[model samples]
Target chain A: MNFNSAAFLVFLPLVVCLYWLLPFRARKYALLMASWFFYMYWNPLLILLLLASTGIDYLCGLGMDRFDGNPGKRKLLLCVSVCMNLGILFFFKYWDFFGECVSGLMAFCGIPYRVPSLNLILPVGISFYTFQTMSYSIDVYRRKCTPEKDFVYFALFVSYFPQLVAGPIERPGDLLPQLKKEHRWRSEDLKAGVRLLLCGFFRKCVVADTCGIYVNRVFDRLLQANALAVAGAGALFCIQMYCDFAGYSEIAAGSARLMGVRLTRNFDRPYLSQSYGEFFRRWHISLNRWFTQYLYIPLGGSRRGLLIRLRNTVIVFALCGLWHGARWTYVLWGLYAAFFVCLESVLEKPAGKITERLNIPLNNPLVIFTRRLYMFLIFIPAALLFRAGSVQEVGQIIQSLLAADFSLTNALGSLGMTSFSIVSLTLTLCAMARIYDFGLYDLPDNGNRTEEAGRQVSGVLMVLVIALCWLALLATEDAAGFAYFQF
Target chain B: MQEWVVLRHPELVLLYGLALLLCLMEKKWKASRGWLFYASCACAAAASAMLILQGADLREAAAYLTVFLLLMPGVRA
Candidate 1:
């Protein structure tokens, strides 16, 4: 269910209470049941997919463990597990795209064959949970982690409701042990978790949702809009996305923490990154780490020459983009990032030397100011492809950006904002800037002094933000589904 | 036309100027970073309120500001 919805508002607290009240051994079972119910809330059919995946991986992990000294048998079991997981993912996610391509080719060749569409529903969180399950089997095969003997705990690790839907993508090693241990609710962890949840609600409902209204308006009519409107849409799109995804992560991490589980953090102040490499390291950290360990390193990583490394980087990102969706635009988005990373790597040495020679203070306010402006300019256009519905739409928006109608008056006039809308927008922007500047991600480790102060401040602020957000949401007409729900 | 320009963009400039001023004051004040954050949040809320009331075309501007907020000094790792 959407976090913004009234149903989830009721569902979250009920599940949390049950989780804490259950005996340690029963807690895993409770979670497993809750997670199944949660997935079924979207579609009852999806529960079958989740169960099938879980059962396959569970048996695979045991099979791999049982065949432990024999390399050939183990490899075969691993292959089976990989095929099953990937097969499900491929059929559900990519079958239509492949079908369309084949159909188009047949039509061109004057063949009367038409590929029939199954109209299959893409299961929500399939990509995330599939990857999570795969990691469990792979880790078992590699002997990095033993097979989880307790079926219930292993199932809960795979399906933990908070991070299950949109994940921080927990590793078997990181998450499994916690499930095996007895969980007693810590007052501190509970307070901290609740605070983070409140912060997340504020970011999502107050900031992200508010910005989304304007972004949708501008993007929906990009062709008719002036350059200013186009630019405004592009810029707002970035913010809307960040708040939407990051807000979800915060809620997930916070909720999990209340249950005494520490999920991986998903974002760092990614935008503040001075370089593309730094940005990737900080942004969607779990996914980047996943690609690095499972994909990049396995593909020879940086052990080869620089050129090979660059090629590998591009390949990884291209897959990363494709992993987000079946669309060509996502593929282009992946290539776009690959281009930046390649360019940054090539220029790293020369750029460093240039900066050093110029003797500009690397962290000087002026240098920081200019670098931020340059990065903002670079980020928006690149991000446009990801937000656009199609390649053509993206092109139209870019073309509008370069057009000659650059009047400030016409731009503001077209937005058709009420006075209240204008005030609300300004307040939202300022609030976002402040949160970003304070390094919201750094709150967990804000030095000793800040930490001590943070306990009291964050507690009070957290309560206030949550109450305010809940109230705002209640007053609003409806909660918008998360922007990333489609993926 | 000129009045609108003066009213809208100038308010934005002033808001930014205030942000910079707050940053400068933060350096001198030695307050906890959390308080600074809270203050900045207050300023942002105020600015957002103004934008909402004024009916400014904020989606794009807010988007740019969000990116700036993200990649800029405060958010820098």
Candidate 2:
């Protein structure tokens, strides 16, 4: 169920209450059952895939531990785990895309081979949980972490409800240990969790959803809109995506916090990053760290020559994009990011010198402003690919943006938006800028008060604002599914 | 089509403009935190109202502004 939905509103509290009420020893089992129920809400059949993966990884972890001294046996266990995790991910996520591509090529060659498509419904959060489970086996094999003896805790670690869907992909080391601890309920933790949930709600329901209306409309009619509209849509898509995904992460982390479990923070103030390298570091930190530790480092990382390091970076990002979806657009998006990262690496020293010579204080208002603008510009094209229905649609949108019809009135008139839209658009921008300015680096410290009094005030205000927004959303009757659910 | 034009909605524009004005004023005035928060809420509500009324193009612009606002702090730092 969607975190924004009324069903989830009821569901979350019920689970949280029951979880706390349960004895410490049974909490993990309680969570595992709740997580399965949560996943089942999407598709009952999908739970089997989860159970299968859980069973495989749990066995693999045990095997790795058992054969710890036998190098050959440990390697075999690792291979089995990799193959099983990747095999499942490939079958569920990429099989259709690969099948279509192969069939299309066969058709072009006049061959009559037609592979029957499975038309499988991708189990919700398969990509996320698979990685979580894989990390457990790999870590155990590498002697980095011990396998959990309790099957239930391991299962819950793989299927924790908060980061289960669209993740700040949790690692076994970070999350597994937390599951073993007795979860104590603290009022401060609950308050902090509630604040985070409300913050996420505002970001998703108010900011992201509202933007989606415009982005979807403009993108849907790409051929008709002018360059301004196309550009506006492209830029808007980036914003919508960040708010939507990050909003979800905030809520997830917040929800977990309410239970006294801390999920890794998914995003820093990513847009504020001066370099593409910095952006990746700040944005989707959990995923980046995961790929770096599990994939990049294993693939020789930067320990090798410069060229190999660059190649590894590209490979990781390309795969990262593919992990997002089966589509080529995601691959292209990955390549687009990889290109910037490689460029940043290549120009790192020179760029540093330039910044020094220009004496651009990193925190100076102008420097910060330019950095944000640059980030927005870089993301526009990447996000265009993300928003497009197909690769061809991306070209059409780009072509529309490059065309010569620059009249503001014609562009705005064609959109046929009401006066209220303009006002909302303007005010939202202003408020967002003010908030961003206040809390970019330290999101939790937006109110700029460390004093208990200030903390209480900010916390209370945030809660009240969120409550009112939730009430408003409920009243509006048009509450929509979160954008990330489709992924 | 003429009736749909948002330029005709003076009251909506005024409410929106007032909300923006209050937000800016809140920053400068250093009033009670509650007052500042209420003003911000009023601005957010007014903006949402404006968004609901406007066409997709204007909504897109609004979204851009909202995103910029959201990220501006991060970008600035």
Candidate 3:
């Protein structure tokens, strides 16, 4: 069930209440059952996959621990677990995409063979849980986290409903230990939890979904749109995506916080980063760290020669893009990001030399702001690449952008928001979102008592305004599912 | 839509006025911002009742206001 839905609104509180009311030993069992119910609420059959992955990893961890002296056997067990998890993911998520690719290759090669697609429905959150479980087995094999001995606790860690579906993909070391502890109800956690939930819902429904109304319209009739419309919609798509995925992450973390379990932070004001390299460090931090630790470090990372580091960066980004979906567009999107990031890294020395020669002050606020804007604008084409249906569609958008019909009225008119009321509503909502994301009106603190109070009060006012706008938005626009749910 | 008309109706004006007053009081009496939370809730609940009496849909401004208050900052703490 979606976190924004009324059903989950009821379910979360009821589950949390029952969890806290139970004793410590029964609490874990209760939480496990609740998590199973939450997962099964989406699809009853997929719960089996969850159980299978959890069981395999749990057993693998135990086996690795038992054969700790035999490095060969430990390595074999880790590989077994990794292969099993990936095998399930491939069957459920990637089988049809693979078949389609092979079929295309066959047709191009003048072969008379056509590969048939099984067209199996992919289980929701397969990629997320698969990566999470693989991390557990790998960590156990590497002697990082002690193997979880308790079956129920381990199961709870794997199926923790909050971050189970779309995650700030938790590591075993971070989350498993918390599963074993007794949590006491705290008012502070509840307050912070509710704050996060409100912020997430406001962003998802009011900002992202409202923007989706226009973005979907423009993309639906790409041929009818001018350059300005496509580019405007491309920028909105970036905002929509960040809000949608980060919205989900915030809600997940907040829900877990209500149960006194703190998940890792996923986003950190990525839009404010002054460079593409800095953007990666802030955006989807958990996944980036995962790639850095498991993939990049294993491939020698930046510690190696420049050629190896560049190769590793490109390979990791390609895999990262492919991890998002089973489409070539996603791969292209990954390559697009890698290109800019690599360019920035390779040109760092020369760019510094040019700035030195020009006598540009690197720490100037205006310069910093300009750099941030440049970094943000760099993502527009990448966003187009990520969201386009096919390579041809991507070409169409780029061609339209190059044609340069940059009229604002023509763009809004094409999206069916030509009327003053609708246009005002869209712009106002977008402004609120920008302010909310960037904190444009933060109360300045001079360390006085009244100023501190004013700061707190201003924050309270911001949430109130966002909440009011969100409610109004719900009355007008239909809330959309998060964009990341597809992956 | 008629929802916008209902939002601007005379009956809802008092609710907004009350919210404004509570907000000002929150600023004046810095030690007692709790009243703003109550005032926000009471205004929403009363507005919802009025809308119900006027034969309007419950999903109008009242419902929105109620949710806004429930999740409004500084309420739980």
- Residue A19's lDDT within candidate 1 is 86
Local accuracy by lDDT, each model: 0.74, 0.74, 0.77
In model 1, the Cα lDDT at residue B68 comes to: 24
Q: What tier of docking accuracy does candidate 3 attain?
A: incorrect
Q: Which stretches of candidate 3 lie over 4 Å from their true place?
A: A418-477, B1-77
* Best-performing candidate as measured by TM-score: 3
Q: DockQ for each of the predicted structures, in order?
A: 0.10, 0.13, 0.13
List where candidate 2 sits over 4 angstroms from the true fold. Answer: A353-365, A413-416, A433-479, B1-77
> Model 3: clashing residue pairs?
none
Give the least accurate 10-residue stretch of model 3 chain B, judged by summed lDDT: B68-77
Report the Cα lDDT for residue A25, model 1: 67
For residue A61, what is the lDDT in candidate 1? 90
List chain A TM-scores, every candidate, in order.
0.92, 0.91, 0.92
Candidates ranked by TM-score, best first? 3, 2, 1
Measured with DockQ on alpha carbons, how good is candidate 3? 0.13
TM-score of 2: 0.83
Per-residue alpha-carbon lDDT of model 1 for A1-487, expressed as tens digits? 8777778879888888998888876787888898888888999888888889999899989988888888999999889988999999989999988788899999999998888877788889888899899888888998999998888887888888887878888899999988777888788777667756766776787677777777777776778778987777778777888888888888888878878887888988777877777888988888888899898999989789889889999999999998888888899989998999888888888989998998878889888877767777778877788888888998888788788688876666555455556765676666565554232333444464433443443334434443444454455543467766666
Tens digit per residue, CA lDDT, model 2, A1-487: 7888777889899989998999987788888888889889988888898899999999888888888789999899899988999999999889989999999999999998876799988777788888888878888988889888888988898889988888878878899888788877898778668767866876777667667767777776779888877777777778778888888998898888889888888888777777788888988888788899989999999989889999999999999898888999999999999999998788888978998999878788887888778977988888888878888997887788778778777566545456666666555545544444222223344554222223343333344434444554455443556656656
* Candidate 3 Cα deviation (angstroms), residue A164: 0.4
